[model samples]
Target chain A: MHAILDADYLCHLGFIRDGAPVVLPTLYARVAERLYMHGSAGSRPLRCAGEDTGIAVCLTVTHVDGLVLARSAIHHAINYRSVVVHGVARQVTDPAERSTALNALINHIVPGRAADSRPANAKELAATAVVALDLNEVSAKVRTGDPNDDPEDLALPHWTGVLPVQRTYGTPVPAGDLDPSVTVPGYLTQR
Target chain B: MHAILDADYLCHLGFIRDGAPVVLPTLYARVAERLYMHGSAGSRPLRCAGEDTGIAVCLTVTHVDGLVLARSAIHHAINYRSVVVHGVARQVTDPAERSTALNALINHIVPGRAADSRPANAKELAATAVVALDLNEVSAKVRTGDPNDDPEDLALPHWTGVLPVQRTYGTPVPAGDLDPSVTVPGYLTQR
Candidate 1:
């Protein structure tokens, strides 16, 4: 579960709004047994988390590893790794914990990035909202290997295989206003 | 919206379950203004959609285009394209529509794949449940370009840029039981 959660920083957060379900894609970071997510202070999820008892949320992260193509359409599937967490998310108000979460959010995207970047000032922190959800009710599911085709369909004139999908990083492009002397950091290049 | 939905086959589906939001990652295909998804007949969402009035769902698809690194932690962001659909998803029972939806699901994963694969048998179709969500309340949100750092913080000795993220396909691996003479199909290889 930890490995899958740490592999990606993006997550889909689901929460009920006005008797209907709403799902939004956002950035999240795992810290020990808790997951922290930050968003605009006025965002619906963030506001709901600020309520007295917090808000019930379902957070999920998925990685599509491959496309399974089988001889029969019914057997076609996708190889993937996913983590789902169901819990009540509460707003983080402690100064120390908020600082730690803010740093984690930055480092989650690029390791060692928090130290290299400027920390959020008081005004910036005030505009951002942080919510934490414990990893207690978390579950991870994974599917791998080749396509599963029926025995009778094996002789059908159709290709059966796994098309592997990979997330690749391209050359980093520097910001327009960046100083030429700064140079790309080792953490960014190494990842 | 069409382009974003067409680019990916996996989606995070959110629906109310026991008064709490439950989000699950599943395969989805877009045909015209309707989104079709299939799962086991016993799945919670599938069963709920079979109810008289169907089930309210929020279906979302996201593509992480790049990681945006800023000079200030508060300004850090992600480049992405996402589509969110809020509507009631009803089960598809008509045989013709079910067949079309199944074919769309397979072709959505790999173009021209439905024709190459054998159609589902009667028993297989009976075990599968198909749900169709109209793209009525659909919205697409996209973020691109470089990181947005505060002007005053640009002089801070920090690296700021966009690290591009791309989904790449690797060489296909045939199933162990697949006929050696079948060979890789053009649709799979070309994709």
Candidate 2:
């Protein structure tokens, strides 16, 4: 399957130091064959639990597994996963370099989306901000599949099965101002 | 909308804390008009860092968005949204009310998934464990879109539109061992 680094799948990436969580809504990263963000401006939406806000940065992403329906209600469970990165996030300041970073940001959220959208203008660039965090300290953890049934419950007359869950996409709705001649991109058709 | 508490849905909930995440395969919970999980056997998933060992737990759920299609690209993004809770989960081990708490968990996840599924037996009940948190803090964030565009490019006249995302459950596959005589329940059919 072709890979997509979408905002919806990306959990918030976070960093915590000295008992605090540093939220970075947009910390560009690459893992295996994927990239992700917390969807929105992570840093912009961060609510710090500490007073000393110098230059803290963190990365976090989550995947949801609805629930595990077991024969015995108590044995029922959930399957899900997530990752978090803790470290220092320095703001990007170089003008030429920052512009390139913005493209990375756009592409990171929707690969090739940068080309579909306009490149940031000088003023827009100034308004936009980027943070670079070294992925030195990171963690990935996951829980997958059914509940651990007791050796005895195996014989119960109840029905036992897993309800597989999958996300689907629908037809696109064009922007109101879109030209009447505009046709929806096929790429968007599947989503 | 009816507030139904599904034990399955509550069991699906997990969180990250202390930088490491601990994900339980299953936990008891309730599903009502709104979802709620009482502090119990839950442990902080992010108790450590690095690999699976460092992650105490990770919470994830996928809400289906429709399907995505790109004439030129196969890269598809699920139009769904999810939230991850990471933190330290202390077992809710009060000797007295654990049973009621377990029922709460069932109702919270699926409103009636617990009642629909088999109930916990005696030995199973004694073995059942619940995780709880004294610091009940969580956040909900989301995103929705087709594609973003630059102001000037709007006049360029390239076909631009948003593919809406939706999730629809397929026919429920029943357990093979069950009696074919039992038809699917009303909730399962409409859902």
Candidate 3:
């Protein structure tokens, strides 16, 4: 649950269309056992999927923790955690549910962001299409710790360890055209 | 070119099989204009793709730079830079090129790792299958700066700014079975 919720970037979405595979990277939000995503109403997948029939889709998120430097090149590997979900995606048509899904998407990127931002207007809501995928078949795979090197190769004169990778918050940059009076948000500083 | 080279983590690989789309997350290295990857000899994509005949593939790498907190939820967005490459992937057979490609993969994760690690043995080389995709049809999209909020919503009592995201190298953790005499590598400390 934590791994799925903590993912910060985009999700690689896979689906089939016209007897060929198509994959897209898009922003995603998790609500209960469902993942929500929004795109332009005219998007290819959304149109081809047919609002009622839905489409078969697969979503995956990955976080690389470190590089496992082993004594032997053959044993070299990366420490990572990943989650994959296979499900059918259907469009969200209800206006209220769509707004909630949209808010979930915003807050997923930055907590408390939805409350701070204005709700979508009628026109904006009409232009956006929301899709939901139920988390039925989901799997998480994680690899941690150090590299597994060969016993004979250990004595070789070589250095080996794990170089950790971390993602952190950098200094906030306000909009250039903003009013000078507006200050940086407190939530931004907490990160 | 910069976006493709500067990516820090994994790449999302997409391909079609049996009229369905399949997407996988894998480590990738870029050498000149060619992207290299390795997998088991029996892997689905590798075996199904065939050795001489290539498979149509799409590779994408993304770096999230910031969270765009807007005054309105409808305008909320993420600041990111991503590169997408569409091409045919072919197997690498020549031993010399295979060795070079493997080294490129190692050094891609950790700059000086290839020199520090032992070269792959003949058996290990036989077990691994390397593939390369040329960077011909590639495109990069970037969104930077701050959120674009509506003019009417500015006066609303809400905070808005860009929360920057940065990925950095952390302290290296030594292997549990590592010999005490072996110290952390200097190249890793530099990161």
Tell me what fraction of the real C-alpha contacts between chains A and B each candidate also makes.
0.94, 0.34, 0.73
**Highest DockQ scorer:** 1
Off by over 4 Å in 1: none
Model 3: lDDT of residue B140: 84
How would you encode candidate 3's per-residue C-alpha lDDT over B4-120 as one tens digit per residue?
A: 455654788888766556678888898888999898978988775555678888887878788887788888887888888787898888888898899989888888889988999
Q: Candidate 1 lDDT, tens digit per residue, B22-96?
A: 999989999999999999999989998999999999999999999999998898999999999999999999999
Model 3 interface CAPRI class:
medium
Each model's C-alpha lDDT?
0.93, 0.45, 0.81
**lDDT ranking from best to worst?**
1, 3, 2
User: Worst 10-residue stretch by lDDT in candidate 3 chain A?
Assistant: A1-10
Which regions of candidate 3 fall more than 4 Å away from where they truly are? A17-20
Residue range with the least summed lDDT across 10 consecutive positions in model 2 chain A? A1-10
State, as a TM-score between 0 and 1, how close model 3 is to the true structure: 0.94
Candidate rank order under TM-score: 1, 3, 2
Q: Give residue B20's error in model 3 in angstroms.
A: 2.5
Cα deviation at B76, candidate 2, in Å, is 17
The DockQ value obtained for model 2 is 0.27
- Candidate with best lDDT: 1
Model 2: chain B TM-score relative to the native chain B:
0.56
